[model samples]
Target: MAKKTVEAALKVEKLKVEITKLKETKKNIDQKNKQLKKLKKKETKTKKSKVEKIEKKKTKKKKVTQLTERKTKEAKEKEKQKAKEAKEKEKQKAKEAREKEKQKAKEAREKEKQKAKEAREKAKEAKEKAERTLEEELQEQLSPEEIEGFQIEKVNMEKLTNKVCVILAEKETTGMIQSELWKKLKLSSRDGSRLALKLERMGTITREKILEKGRWTYKLIIKKTPISTESIENAPCLTCPVEQKCTLEGEVSPRTCEWIEDWVTIEIKKPKTAQ
Candidate 1:
C-alpha cells in the first residue's frame, strides 16, 4: 500500500507542471493578437489617405474639363452671333439694291415721258409754221381775179384713186394698214377710210380686219393687176368651145386641145397669169 501511494503522488506533481506551461502559452497568444490589431489599424489609415488624395485629383481634372467645355460653348455662341450679323448685313444690302433699281426705273420712265412731251410740242410748232408759210406763199402768188374765185373744194375722186393706186404700186407691199396709207396720202382718217372702202367696192383691193395698236384696223390687200376677174369670167372659150362637154375623156377635152395644153404647161407656175 505504501508503494501504490508513492506512484499516485508522483503522477499529481507531473500534472501540476503541465498546467503552469499552458497558462504561459495563453499569455503569449494574447500579446501576438494585440500586435496584429495595431498593424491592421495602420494599414487602414494609409489606405484612407490614398483614397482622399485620389478624390482630390479626380475633382481637379473634372474642373479643368468643365472650363474647356464652357470655353468651347462660348466660342460657338460667338460664331453664331457673327453669322447672324453677316446675314442681316446681306439682307440690308439686297433691300438697298432693290430700292436703287426701283428708283432707276422710275427715273427712266419719267425721262421717256418728258422726251415724248417735247417731241409732241416740237411737231405742233413745226406744223403751224408750215401752214402759215404755205398760206403766205399762196396769197403772194395769186392774182386778184384768181383769188376772188379761189374757193376750197373736196379733192377729186379720180385724182385720189390715182394717188392711192400709185402709192400701192410704188410700195409693192402685199398688205398695208389703214393708218399707213393716210400717212403717205396726207388725207384725214375719215376721208382715207372712205377712199379705202370705195376701192374695196371697186374690187381694186381687199380689206380684212386685223388687231393692231390694241384696236381693230383694216389691212388693205391690193389687187393691182390689170387683168380683172371679170375678164376671166367673160373669156371666149368659157362662153363657146363646148364648155359642157369639156372633160379629160370627152371629145372637147382640155388635154386634147393644143391651146389649153400649151397654156397650162407654161402658166401653171405663174400665179400672175389666169390659167
Candidate 2:
C-alpha cells in the first residue's frame, strides 16, 4: 500500500509540469496574433494616405488647366478690342483728310473769282481813259475860228434848222446820246459836236454831260422846233388878181376878201406832212 501511494504522487507532479508548459505556449501564440493585427492596420492606413495624395494631385492639375483657359480668353478679348479701336481711328483720319481737301478747293475758286473781277474793273478804267484822251486830241485839232465858221454846204438854212429841230423833237425828253445821233444823221463827230455848240448858243437845244460805253460824252435834248415856210407855199397872196393896194382897212382890204378867205380855209383843212 505504501509503494502505490508514492507512485500516484509522482504521476500528479508530472501532470502539473505539463499544464504549466502548455499555458506558456498559449501566451506566446496570443502575443504573435496581436502583432499581426497591428501590422495589417498600419498597411491599410498607408494605402488610404496614398489614395488621398493621388486625388489631391488630380484636383490641382484640373485647377491649373481652368486658370490657363480663362487667361487665354481674356487675352483674345483684349486683342479684339484693340483692333476695333484702330479701325475707328483710321476712319476718322480719312474723314478729316477729305474735309481739308474740300476746303482747299473752295478757297481756290474764291481766289479765281476775285481775280476775274479785278480784271474786269481794270478793263473798264482803261477804256474810259482812252476815250477821254481821244476827245481831248479831237478838240485840239480844231481852231476856234474854224469851229465858229462851221457850216453844212448846199442846204437851205431855214429848212435845215426845221429838219434838225423836228428830228430832235421826235427823240422825246430823255433825248439821244450825241454819238448815236451823229451816226443816224450821217455826220462826222467833229461836225456834230460843233453843231451842238451852235445849237446851245442859239437856245434851240441843250447838251448834258454823261457817261456812255465807259466814256465821257454828251446827250442832246431839243428845246424848240423852228417853223417851216412850206406851209404857206400855196397861199393866194402873191397870185391874187388884186393889185398891191390891199390893206387892213381900205376898199380892197384883205380882211374882207372872199378869195383870200376861201384860200386860207382850204390851206387849213389840208393834211400836214413832215418836211
Candidate 3:
C-alpha cells in the first residue's frame, strides 16, 4: 500500500513538472508579445518626434520664406529626404521585431506541443498500470470456485505429435486445413498453431499459409516416409523375429548377420522385392 502510494505520488509529481513546462512556454510567448508591442510603441514615438521636428522647421522657414525663397526650397528638399530615411529605418526595425516574434512563437508552440505529447504518453502509461494493478487485486481476491469456467492443462507433446501424425497419414498427400484439423483433434487454435509450427520446424510436416475470408489460415501437408518397394523388401528388420529387442549393439544384431550380407550382395548385383 505504501509503495503504491509512493508510485502514485511520483506520477503526480511528473505530471506537475509537465504542467510547469507548459506554463513556462506560455509565459515566454507572452513576453515575446510584450516585447513586440514595445517595439511598435517605440516606432510610434519616433514618428511623433519626426512630426514635431518637421513642424518646427516649417515655422522657422515661414519667417525666412519672403526674404530667401531659393534657400527655403533647398531646406524643404533636405527635410523630405530626412523624413524618408527615418521612415525606412523604422520599417526595418519593425520588420526585424516581427520576424523575431514569429520565430519565438513557433518555438513556444512546438515546446507546448511536445509537453502535451509527453503528458498524454504518461497518462496512457498510468492508466495501463492502474488497470494491471486492479486486475492483480481482483485475481488475489477471487477463489478457484469464484472464477471456475476456464481450465488450463499441460499438453502431452509426444502424444499430441503421434496423434497428429496419424491423422495426417490418414489424409495422405491431401492436407487438411488448420481450423478443421484442430476442431477434429479437439485442440485449441493457439495450441494447434504452435504444434503445426513445431512440426514444420522439425521437418515432420509442411505448413502452408492460405488466405480464407481475408484472414490467414494454415494448410498442413504431411511429409511421407521415403521407402521404395525394393528397399522395404531388402530391409533385414522386416524378417527379424526379435525386432522389438534388436539393437545395433545387441546379440540379435545386424552386425554379424550372414543373411543380410548375402541379401545386400545380391541386391547390389540385382535389385528385387523380398515378398
Candidate 3: minimum summed lDDT over ten consecutive residues — where? 143-152
- The candidate 1 region of ten consecutive residues with least summed lDDT is 266-275
Model 3's C-alpha root-mean-square deviation from the true structure amounts to 46.5
What are the TM-scores, per candidate, against the unseen true structure? 0.29, 0.39, 0.30
For 1-275, candidate 2 gives per-residue lDDT tens digits of 67778777777777677777777777777777777777777777777777777777777877777778787888888888888888888888888888888888888988898899888888888875665633355457766666556577754545555656778899968887888877876667876787777676667888887878876888889997656667557767768777588889899988899878998899768754322
User: Whole-model Cα lDDT per candidate?
Assistant: 0.67, 0.74, 0.71
How would you encode candidate 3's per-residue C-alpha lDDT over 130-171 as one tens digit per residue? Answer: 444322343466554443322225554555566677688788
Model 1: which residue pairs collide?
none
As a TM-score, model 2 comes out at 0.39
Q: lDDT tens string, model 1, 31-91?
A: 7777777777777777777787788778878888888788888899889998998999999
For model 3 the TM-score comes to 0.30
